[model samples]
Every structure is written in structure tokens, then in C-alpha cells.
Target chain A: MNWLTWRQHRAQFLFGAATLAVITLFLVPSGLGIWHTFRSTGLAGCLAVTGRDCGDLASTFSDRYTGLQFTIPLFMILPALLGVFWGAPLVAREIEQGTHRLAWTQGLTRLRWMSTKVVTLVLATLAGAAVFAFLLSWWSRPFVAASDNRFSFGVFDLRGIVPVAYALFALAAGVAAGALIRRTVAAMGATLGAYVAVRTGIELWARPHYEAARTISYSFFGSGPHPGSGDWVLSTRTVDRAGHLLGNGQSLDFNVLHARCPDLPGPSSGFVSKAPIQACIQRLGIHLQATYQPGNRYWLFQGIESAIFVGLALGLLAFAVWWVRRKVA
Target chain B: MTTPAALTATALGKRYRGHWGLRDCSLEIPAGRISALVGPNGAGKTTLLHLATGLLAPTAGTIETLGRTPGEDPDLLPRIGFMAQDVPLYRSFRVREMLEFGRRTNPGRWDAELAQGRMDRASIDLDQRAGTLSGGQRAQVALALALAKRPELLLLDEPLAALDPLARREFLKALMEGAVDGEVTVVLSSHLLTDLERVCDHLVVLSGGRTQVAGDIEGLLEAHRVLTGPRRDVDRIEGVAAVVQQATTDRQSTLLVRTDGPIIDPAWSVHRVDLEELVLGYLGQPNATALPAPRLARTGAEVSR
Candidate 1:
């Protein structure tokens, strides 16, 4: 069974190797170039320096490599690509070609055939995703140094063990969809769609809420919440002396400002100016506050997200085995 | 102890989404005999073969091949070889790889010598991809895979469909050579009666999702005869056990009847029926029963008829 799986999937392995080589050709130069610029511009030292804010210098250096941001996000599609190309066709191709009859009747059980192919492909997917994440993490190091933020959407998933978990989920989803649908092209499409949906759905609805966001407050008119710099600020709001809620961007109206600080200013075009509002807030002892997931929790969040994806992957694979064994031909 | 049948099914039935593909089918093909499974389209012939392979499970009753239920026991698979009608092979694999696949998959039972001989006899190119091969080559490769497993019972569905007349003759000749001297029991299902008659010793006829007639060919042939006489009621004929087919002109009535004894009526002439005529006679009238044999594959040729 193992021999058959390898013989059948050798073409896919070769394609994967060639694809990795092409990606390496592109990653090596950009990574080195970014590293060189960071050193030359003195921002590399600031990555380790803790005394002062490096935001200005970091932004200037990072802006020079704007092309890096665009290209790196493209790697995010690798998981879905694995699902479509590797997972969807694994079993679908066999049934579609009517070779399941040949494979199942050759003294080996169907369960063995399914498990062998799935296990072999899964090991390969994990190894490939791990290697990819390593290169991506290495290449994006200067970006991390410049931004001091690892939780950025496109950037975060690219640099951690979560990508490996996502790869597993994608591959399993593909295989399960293939087993259920029994059509290679349709299963491939479903795998791609499901991978993207689950990934973005988790990022948008599940990740931030893994733990409650911590709150930090600052005096009005002062440099506000520099302590929340590396964290993901879900929202920033103003609170009064008594801790009454204030507008967040548009949470409060100009009428409320007029009612509280009547002598400050009148509404212009249904909006109050920020200068007077800042003065009124200072006069009232209102505070600016940020709700965020702390940057120090990066690895913890990575662990948690990886657990969710890997759990989902295992579930999908289990469902696939059950479907193949019980429901399918 | 009596030897167990190579393949047997009791009240075997399969139902698809909205209709039954096979129903109330019970048959036992004896060991060491080549059997022909004959049926019209939608007659459950392929369904019976699929049930034997355990590819499609029986919905109603049990089907046992080589004395074990397929799909329930993994060990039974290697013991029963099956050639599906379409001759589905791995299109991407080279002929060499397919043989390797058979060898690797069937581990202990695989006969590498027999496989190589089949390849050589067919003059198959080892380097060529199966997808690129001609239809004849594909069928040969399929057969080679099934045969090289050295199964005790081989179920072949439409195995000779893709071959030419000469190839068909050679194929039947090969099957005759295999089953006559070897331990393998082959059940070949095809519409070509001539080809089947050349190789098969036992017979099974399926129609309307049921077994119409099943017995040894020679015995079935012997028990049935065509009687030409004056047009009269068949029920009045004392020697005839059952009427399989009836045709009449203005003054003459010809009846094909299954008899337990010789037709001795002076008014009628009895002619021994051929294999094709016997099968067609049974098939022409779906309701005809050839007087159920003692066994599914029983040869009652020693009887008076």
C-alpha cells in the first residue's frame, strides 16, 4: 500500500520540489536585501533597543521595501493550493478513473489503501509547510523588526506553526471533500473554497476572542497609549472622569459634546472639530483607552490557533475515514 | 465432508436509490467448473458479479464467495479475482508499474512468473502507459492482473467484449485451458452464447432481477427437448414436465419442454435441443421454470431424459 501511494504521488512530489525551488529563488535575495538595509539604517539595533520609540526609523526603513509586503502575502495561498492540488484529487482521481476496483481487490483492504495515501500525503504536507514557514519567518524578520507587530493578519499566519496546522486542515479538507463528492474537479473547488472560508472565518471571528483584550488608559492630550504599540488594538475610546463611555471615532455625537462642554464649539456640518473636543476632554479629565491583545501573548495565540486548526484537520480526516469505510463504494 | 461451493448466494438482492438492481437471486456455482452468467440488459448479471467482488453489498440476503462473505473479511479478497466489465486500469501507470502494483498489493499470492508469461504471450510493451494502449491490450492486461492473483474463484464480466472474433476464440481457449486443468473456477458473464458454449461447463441465466435457469449445461440441454406435433393443449401431454417455449402454425404446434423421461408419444417427433436453443427457450418466456435442479449447479444428465 505504501509503495502504491508513493508511486502514484511521485509526480506531485516532484512538482512540489520544483515549486519550492522557484520560491527559494525569489525569497533568498529579498530576505538578504532587507537584512542589509535594516543593518545599514541602524534599525536592526533598535529591534533590541528598549529605551525609546523606534517607530519613525522603523517605518522609514520598512517603507523602502514596500514590494516585500505585497509579495509575502501571496504565500498565504499555499495552504489552499495544497488542499486543491494534493487533497482533493487524492481519492477522487482514483474513483473517477475507476481504479478503486483494481486497488481494493488486490489483497489489500480499502482501509489500508485510504490510510496509506492520507498518511503519506499528510506527512509530506506537514514537512512542506514547516519548511515554507521557516523560510517565510526568516525572510520577514526585518519586517518584524521594523513593525514590532507579529499579529498583523497577512503577516502573522505566514510566520508560525499555525501555517503548518492550516496546511494540515487544508489537505484533510481536500481529502474529505474528495471522498464525499467523488469528483476531482468539484472536490478541488470545494476544498479551495472551504479552506479560504474556514481560515478567514477563524481570523475574523475566532482569533482575537481566544482571550479577552486587555485595556490601557492614558491622560488626555498626552502621547496616548504608546504601551499598546505592538498589540492589536481592537478599539480605542474615551472615558470621562467618572469612567462614562465616550465616542469611539463615531460612538458619541457632537450634541453630547455640546451638552457636556457647551462653551467649546458648535457643530460644523454635523461634526465637531477635534481640537476643541481634545480641550474639552482635557478639561473634563477624560482618558483615552485602548482594548488590545498584548504582543507578549504572540506565541500563546500561535499555540491556541494551531490547536484549533490541527484539531479541525484531525476531525476532517476522521470524517473522511468514516465516509470511505461506511458510506462510500 | 461435502466440498463447499466456490461461490454461493442465497436470496441475494441489491437496491439502488429508487429501484432494485437485483432481487430474490439465489445461486451456487460449483467448484472447479467454468460457468456462464447469461442475462439481458438490466437482468442483474453485472449486479451479481459486483456482489461477489464485494464492491456493492447485497441489500437483502447473503452472498458468499469461497465460503466467506466479501467486504466483511479482508482475506477473502485475494482468494477471489474479479474482472469488471469496463476493464478499468490505472491509465497513468506504465504496464510494468501495473504488474508491480499487482505484485505489491497481492504480496503472498502474487504469481510473478504467471504475470510475466501473460505479458509475454500478449506481446505487451512494458514501457507503454496503459492509457495509450489499444482496447485489446487493456483487456489483456486486466485479465492478466486478475489471473496472476491465482484466486480460487474468478468472476469475469464481459471479459471478451473488447476482443475480435479471433481474439475471442483464443481467449475462450485460454480460459478452457485454465479452468480444465487448474484449480481456479471462472464465472464468465457475456451475451455471446457461442463463445460461452465453447468454454463454460455450468450455466446461470438471470432475467428480471431473478435467476431464470441455473444448472450444468449438458444436463440442462439433456432435460429439454423440442416436440413437433399437432396443435393441442400442452397440459394434456403426460411426458412433459414443463413447457419453456411454444409456437404454432395452423396445423402444427412445436413445444420446447423439460421432461423427466423420454418423449414416447407416437404423434410427436422429439429433437434434442442445442445450448443456444435451450438458453433462448428459457429466456424467450421469462416465466418458464426448467424444473429446479437438486443443486444450483447440479448436473442431472444421468436421469432418463
Candidate 2:
């Protein structure tokens, strides 16, 4: 079986490697440019707001670096096309060409012939996915680190471990579609459609929940000084000027403040004076904390998603195996 | 008589979408005998061949090759080489590659020298792509692939249908020479009666999904006769047991009669039918005993007997 598969796909494997090399050459310069841009701008303190330093420039770079996002997805698309154009035609072409009859009437069973093909293609798909994932991960690190926008989340979210899952899923889905459709063109189209839908669905609706759970916010304002204070008379409000909540802005009214600051002893005792407005105003600076952090959760989510997709891929692979085994031609 | 049967179909039947392709079509070919399956366009000859070779599953029957069911055992496949009608081959593969593929996949012991000899006799170039060959040349290649397996039984569907007379004769001569040792039993189907008569010893005639007549070629011809006379005198013919075919116009009548006795009628003339006439007579008859099966010897029976 291994020998047969190797004979069948040796051409495609060589072609795939050449294509990957060309893509890598193009990506290297682009990756270096991204790294230089990141170095020229400050690492942490770069202002990413108002489309000047942080918001618009960062968004434009993120969009330009969109090619990095496409690397894994594009690599994944190759296997599906292989399955459809090359792999799907594996059995059907034999039957269509009437070579299968000759082969089957020999000592080899139809099941064995199909099994060899699927196993070989699956291995190829994995190897391709692994190489692409490694290159994309290495290339897109600087850009991924620089961008803080939610849109950047979609592009680089599946970077480290998730692309593996995406690739496997795409491969399995392509093979299954090929088996079911039995035509090269139809199988390719179906595989692409299914991959796009599943990947898009996961990124848009399901991924944000992991990041939303871990955010924190804070705000502050200045207030007048108290007469009985020992050294300084000046005072300040901890909250913003309009009294709006900060750090991912959720409102912090009196009830919320009291609930959070229940152990503050007497508010007036904590302050120099017992003036309620002044004491309350002094403690008005806002702080909000969430349990889940986006970056940390991103890896966890990637790992979990990869596992789920891997399982789905296995299921699809099993179906493809079963389908090939039962194939009549 | 002690040797194993080369091919056997026991109550083999196949149906496609409620239409009968083959039904209760049972046959056995003893080793060394050249058997021919003669049928019309839709007589299910291809279906029967496919079933016998395990290319298709029988709807309700069994096919055995060398005492083992071909469908149940993959090992049996290599022992019986088959050439399907129109002989589809990979256009990209040269003759050498095609033969190499056959050698790689076939489990039986193949004689490379013997295959080369057969190819040489058929005048097929090893370097030419199968698609580039003429129709007759392609047929020769197909035959070469089957012969390479050195199979115990070879099933060919319309082996010479596309060949010119000269090529057909060459193919038959080569096939006869190849099977001279009586190790190979052949069951081939052909619409051309003369080709079957030249190479085949036994005959199985199928019409409308059933075996209409089957026997040694000589025996089939000996039992059937063609009678031509005036339309008014057709019923008056005497000493005839059965009429297999009858065509009546206003002026004259022609009848195909089957009988074991001598024809002595002065008013009617009886001519001994050839295998062609006999097969045509049976095929022409609407009610010519579906599966008019003849007794055949088991494997290793003498062809002359």
C-alpha cells in the first residue's frame, strides 16, 4: 500500500514543496519589514489611537500583513485541491478509464487500493500543514504582537496550534467531499465551501467569549483638599472627569462602588474630612477587573479548538475510509 | 477428467434496476476447451463475464474458479484473466508500462518470455502508448495483458470484433498456439460466428437474458437445419420434430428445423446449418427454449470427444 501511494503522489509532493518554497521566499522579506516597523515604533508605549500612531497605521499594517494570515489557510487549501483534483480522481479515474477492473480482478482488493491512497494523502496533508504552520508562526510574530485591535484577532488567532487543526479538518473534509461527490470539480468546490464556513464561524462567533471574560478597566479625577489634613490640602477624584467608568468603560455608580469597596471602613474616616461629597468624590476614581485575559485565553482556545477539529477530522477520515472501502469501481 | 474446472457459474443471475441482465445462467468450462459465448447486443454476455471474473457481484448466484468462489476469494482473480469489450486501457501508459502494471498486480506466475513472444507475434510495439495503437493493435495488447498472467482460464468479450480479417486470423492462430498445451481454458464472446467457429470447440448462445442453446459447435450444427419452400407447403413438411425459426412471405417460406433424423421430403429441401445459421435460427426464434443447455464434460475432458 505504501509503495503504491508513494508512486501515485510522488509528483504532487514535489510540486507542493516547490510551491511552498516560492511562497516562503516571498514571505521572508515581508516578515523582515514587519519586524523593522515594529522596532522603529516603540514596543509598548506606541499610541495606537485616532488613526495616527496606533489605530489607523496599525490597522493598515494589519491589513497589509493579511498575507501572513493567508499563509496557513492557503496551505490548507492545497491539500483539499489535491484531494479533489488528484485524490478524488484516484479511484474514479481508474474506474472511468477501466483500469480498476484490471486492478481489482488481480490479487488486490478494492478496499486495499483505496486505503493506500487515503493514507498516503493524509500523511502528505499533515506534513504540508506542519511546515506552513511553522513558517507562518515564525513570520507573523512581530505583527501579531504589535496589533491590539479585535480584527487582528481573526488573522492571527489560529497561528500557533490552531492551523494544525484547520489543516487536518480541511484535508478530511476535502477527502470526504471527494468521496461523496465523485467528481473533481464538485469535490473541490464543496471542500472549499465547507472549510471557509467552519473556520469563519469559529472565529467570528465563538472566539470572542474567551477574551471578553478577562478584561479590566480604571478611571480617575481630582477633587478639593480637606481643612483637617495634616500636610496637603489638595484632594483628587479616582474616577474620570465626567464620572464615567474606564478601562473598557462600564459605569461605576454609588451602589457598585460601595459593593466593591465594602471593606474601606468608614469612607469619612478614610478621608481627612467627614464631608460626604468630598469623601465620596475623593474615592471616585474607577477600577474594573475581569478574570479572563485575551492573550492567555487565545492559546488555550487554540489548543481546545485544535483538539475538537482534530476529532472532527478523524471522524471525517473514518467516513472517507468507509466510503472508499465500499466503493464499487 | 480428474483435473479442476477452469470456470463455473452456478445459477448465476444479475439484475439491474429490475431488468434482468443474466438469470439462472449456469455454465462450466473444463480445462483446455475453447468455449464461445454467442449472444446479441443485450444478451448479458458481458454481465456473465464480469460475474465470473468477480468484476460484478451476482444478484443471486455463485461463480467458482478452480473450486473456489471468485467473489469470495481475491486469490482466484489472478488465475482467470479477462478482456472486457472495447478493451479500455490507460492512454498515458506505453505498452511496456501497461504490461508491467499487469505483472505487478497479477498474483499468478507469469511467463515474461511467453508474453514477449505473444507480443511479437501480434506485432505490437512496446514503446507505443496504448491509445496510439490501431484498434486491432489495441486488441492485441489487451490479449497480451491477459495472456501474460498465464491464467488457467481466459475470458474475452468480443476479442476479435474490431479486428480486420487478417488480424483476426493472426489473433486466433496465436491464441490456438498459446493454448496448445491445454493448460488454458478460454471463454470468449463474439458476434462474429466465423471467428468463434475457428477457435471455439464449445458454444453457449444467449438471447434475451437466457441461454438459448449450448453445446459442442459440431453438435449444434448437426442438430439444426434450414428448410426453404413455398409458403403453402410449409406445414406439409414431414419427418421434422421442431421448427426453431420460420419466416413467411406471400410467395415463399423459409423455416429453420431442428431434428435428429434424416430429411427425405421430395417437396422440401433441407440443408445442414452451420454454427452461424444455427445460432441465428435460435436467436431469431421468440420462444426457442430459454437456456437450451447442452451437457458438457467437467475439467480435463478431451476436446475431440
Candidate 3:
């Protein structure tokens, strides 16, 4: 059974191997060069030193290596590709060719067939996803450090174990869709759509709420309790004395000065300079409120997101098995 | 259940969407007999075969193969072989790979020697990709796979549809020759009444989601005879009034009757009915309630013979 599965999926395995080779070929030299430049140009030295500005070194390093950074973003669709090519075709091809009936009646029980085929493909997916994430994380170490921000959306998804989860979830969704639809191309399209919808939905709507975001409110003019660059600042608002949440922080002057400083002489003319408005806001004791997920919770968020996707993947897989056993005609 | 019949169904039915595909289907096929399941396009022959293979579950009642529930026991799968319509093969796989698939999946039960012998006789090369094979070649390969598994029961659905007349004759010969060597019970479904008549001794005719007629060919043929008698209703016969068809002219009546004993009416002249006429008669009138059922109720002992 295992041999049969391997023979059936040999092309997909070869494709995965070739992709891993290509990625390795491209990223290894580029990553080593980035690390070398970081050390050779004294950027690493400047960062380590306490009082050094590191501005020139940092800009020089960024200028030299920024072009290669765009290469990493191309792999953003790797999980989607796995879903379309490897996962969706797994069962749909069998059904389309009518080999599913052949296999099922070959004294190969449905349980063994599903376990051998689905498990091997999903395991391959896990390995491929893990390798890509590891390579990208290693390659992006310099960039992540220089910006002091790895918690951003695109960077966060590709740099940690969540990519592995995403790939597994995509593969499982593809297999499930293939089992249900029984047509290869349509199942691939559905898998792609579902993978994007679910991943982005969780990233956009549910990720921030994984943990209650801590908020810091400080006086408008005075910078206090500043959010770290690594922190994911979900929202920032400037409130007036009446406590209405302001839209954009740039319009802080319009929101505060007119509301609390009605007694000021500038009621007839808008102040072009910043001195009077700052003084008025300082006197009014207005504050800026910012909500953020702390930087230290990066691994914690990874764990939570990975758990959700893995759970979903398992559920989809179970549904697929049920469908194959009971519903397939 | 004295000695379990090779295949048994009790009020078996299958439904697709909202409509019944096979309804009130009940029959028993004895072991070691080559039975032909004949039906027209919408007669649920494929549905019944798939249900017996456990590929399609029943919507009502039950089906058992080899004295066990189909697909329920792990051990039962290896004992049964099925060739689906068009004899589906992994087109991407070489013929050798398909053989290997059968061998691996069946474990110790695969008869590699028999499979190779059949393949060689069919003139199919082991290295040829299944996609490149002709329809006749595909059927040969599929049959080899099923026979190679050394199953006690073999079910084939429309295996001859892919063959030319000559090839179908050869294929049926090969099937019987192969099945006879292993004492295998084979139930094959097809629309070719002529071909089945030549090869099969047992018969099952399906029409309107029901088993219109079923019995051993010799018994069915013996029970039914064309009777030419003075003009009268078929029910006026002195035995089981199982008239398949009745045609009356001004002075005489000719009717096909299936009965428990030979018609003894001296006013009647009786002639034998062939397999083709018998099959067509049942299939043509799907709504006929007076079934030619003398052979329909065969005892287990009678079937085992």
C-alpha cells in the first residue's frame, strides 16, 4: 500500500524536492552574505554598543541587502501551492480516473487506504512547510533584528511554526474538498479559496484577541510608556476631555484644543505653530491611549495560532474520512 | 440458514437523491455457479452489484456475500473480487504496477503465477502503461487482477462492454476457464443475452428495481414452455398460473407459462423456451405482476446442486 501510494504521488514528491532544492540554492548564499555584511560593515558592532547611533551602518546594510528581501515574499503562496498541487489532486485524481473503485475493492480496506495515502501526503506537507519556515527564519534574522519587529503580519506568519500549521491546514482542506467534490481542478480552486479565507480571517480578526491587549494611556504632549517596535500595536487613539475616541492621531490638535480650552484667546484664529496648542493640551490633561500585544508573547501567539490551525486540520481530515467511507458512491 | 448461499439479499434497495434506484430486490445466488445478471439501462443491475461489493450501501434492508455482511468483516474483502464497469485501471501505472498493487493489497492471497499466465495469454506486455492499452487489453488486465487475488466470489459489472464480438467470446471463454480452475463463484452483469446464454448456467433478470426472474438456467428453461391450446385465459391452467405472456387468436391461445410441474392439458401443445426469449419476455413487461416465478423460489439444497 505504501509503495502504491508512493508510485501514485511520485510526481508531487519530486516537485516538492525540486522546490526545496531551488529554495535552498537561492537562500543559502544570500543569507550567508547578509550575515557577513552585517558583521563586516560593523552594524552588528554598533548594535551591540550601548551609546552608538548605528544609523549610518544600519542604512548601509539595509541599502546593500534590501533587494534580496523581496525574494522571500514570493513564498507567501507556498502553502496555497501545496494545497492546489499535492493535496487536492491526492484523492480527486483517483476518483477522476476511477481508480478509487479499483483500490477500494483490491482487498485494501478504506481505513488502510486513507491512512496510507492521507497520512503520507500530510506528513510530507509538514516536513516541507517546516523546512521553508526554518530557511526563511534563518534568512530573515538580520532584517528582523535590525527592525526589532518580527511580530508583524507577513513576517510573523512565515518566520515561525505557524507556516507549518498553515500548510497542514491547507493540505487537509484540499483533501477534504477533493473528497467532497470529486473533481481535481475545482477542488484545487476551492482549497486555495478556503485556505486564503481561513488564514486571513484568523490573522485579521482573531489573532489580536488571542490575548487581552495591554493598554497605556499617557499625556498627549509627553511621551511615556512607549510601545516597543516588536510589539503589535493593534490600535492607538487620542481622546478628548469628553472621552470620545479620536480617529487618527494626527488630528490630535483639532480634537483636544477646541474641546477643553474654550477660554483661550485662539478661539478666533487657528494656531499655525505648535507651542500654544501643546500648552493648552498639557493644561487640559488629555491622554493618548494605545493597545498592544506585548513582544514577549510572540511564541505564545505562535502556539495559539498553530493550535487553532492544527485542530482545524484534524477536523477537516476526520470529515474527509467520514465522507469517503459513508458518502462516496 | 443451513448452508449459506453464496450471495443473499433481503428486500435490498438503493436510493439516489430522492428516487429509488433499486427497490424490493431480493435473490440468492448459489456458490460455484456462473450467474448472469441481465437488465436494461435503468434496471439497477450496477446498483445491486455495487451494493454486494460494499461500494454502495443499501437504503433499505440488507445484502450479504459469502455468508457475511458485505465490507463489514475485514476477512471478507480478500474473499471477493470485483471488476467495475469498463474495468477501471490506474492509467498512469504500468501493467506490472497494477499487478503489484493487487499482490501487495491482498498479501498472501495473491496468485502471481496465475496472473502472469493470464496476462501472457491475453498478449498484454507487463511494462505497458495502462493508459496506452486498448479496451480489450484493459479488460484482460482487470480480470487478471481480480482472478489473481484468489477470491472465492468474483463480481464483474459490464466487463464485456469494452470488447468486440470476437474479443467478448474469447474473454468469456477465458473467464470461465480461469474461474473453473479455482472453483470460484462468478456473477457477471451485462446486456448481452446471447453471450451470457453461452457461458452462464445460472440467471438473474432485473427489471424496474426488482428481481423479475432468478434461477439456474436449466431449471428456469425446464419450468417455462410455450403452450398452444384452445382459446382460454392463462389462469385456467391446472397448476401454478405463472404466465409470463399470453397471446390469443380467434381459435387458439399461445402462452408462456412457468410452472411447478409440466402442463398436462391434452388440448395444449408445449414447446421449449430459450434463454433469450425468457429474458426478453420478463424485461419487456416491467409492470407485469404475474411473474414467471416457479424457479424464483429455489431451495438452498436445490441451488447448491
DockQ winner among the candidates? 1
CAPRI level of candidate 3? medium
Residue A239, model 2: Cα distance from true site in angstroms: 19
- Per-residue lDDT of model 1, residues B141-239, tens digit only: 888888888888888989887889877776666566555556889899987788889778889999888888888888889888999989876565667
Report iRMS (Å) of candidate 1: 1.1
Q: What fraction of the correct interface contacts does each predicted structure contain? A: 0.73, 0.45, 0.75
Global lDDT of each model? 0.83, 0.67, 0.83
In order of listing, the candidates' clash counts read 0, 15, 0
Q: Point out the higher-scoring one by lDDT: 2 or 3.
A: 3
Q: Higher-DockQ candidate among 2 and 3?
A: 3
Tens-digit lDDT string for candidate 3 (B271-291): 899999878876665644322
Model 2 TM-score (2 dp) = 0.76
TM-score of the B chain in model 1? Answer: 0.93
Q: Is model 1 an incorrect, acceptable, medium or high docking prediction?
A: medium
Cα RMSD (angstroms) for every candidate in the order listed: 3.5, 9.9, 3.8
DockQ of each: 0.72, 0.35, 0.70
Per-prediction TM-score, please? 0.93, 0.76, 0.92
What is the lDDT for B48 in model 3?
93
| Per-residue lDDT over A124-232 for candidate 3, one digit per residue giving the tens place of the 0 to 100 score | 9988888989998998887776765777867898888999999999999999999999999999999999998998899999999999999987777665343334687
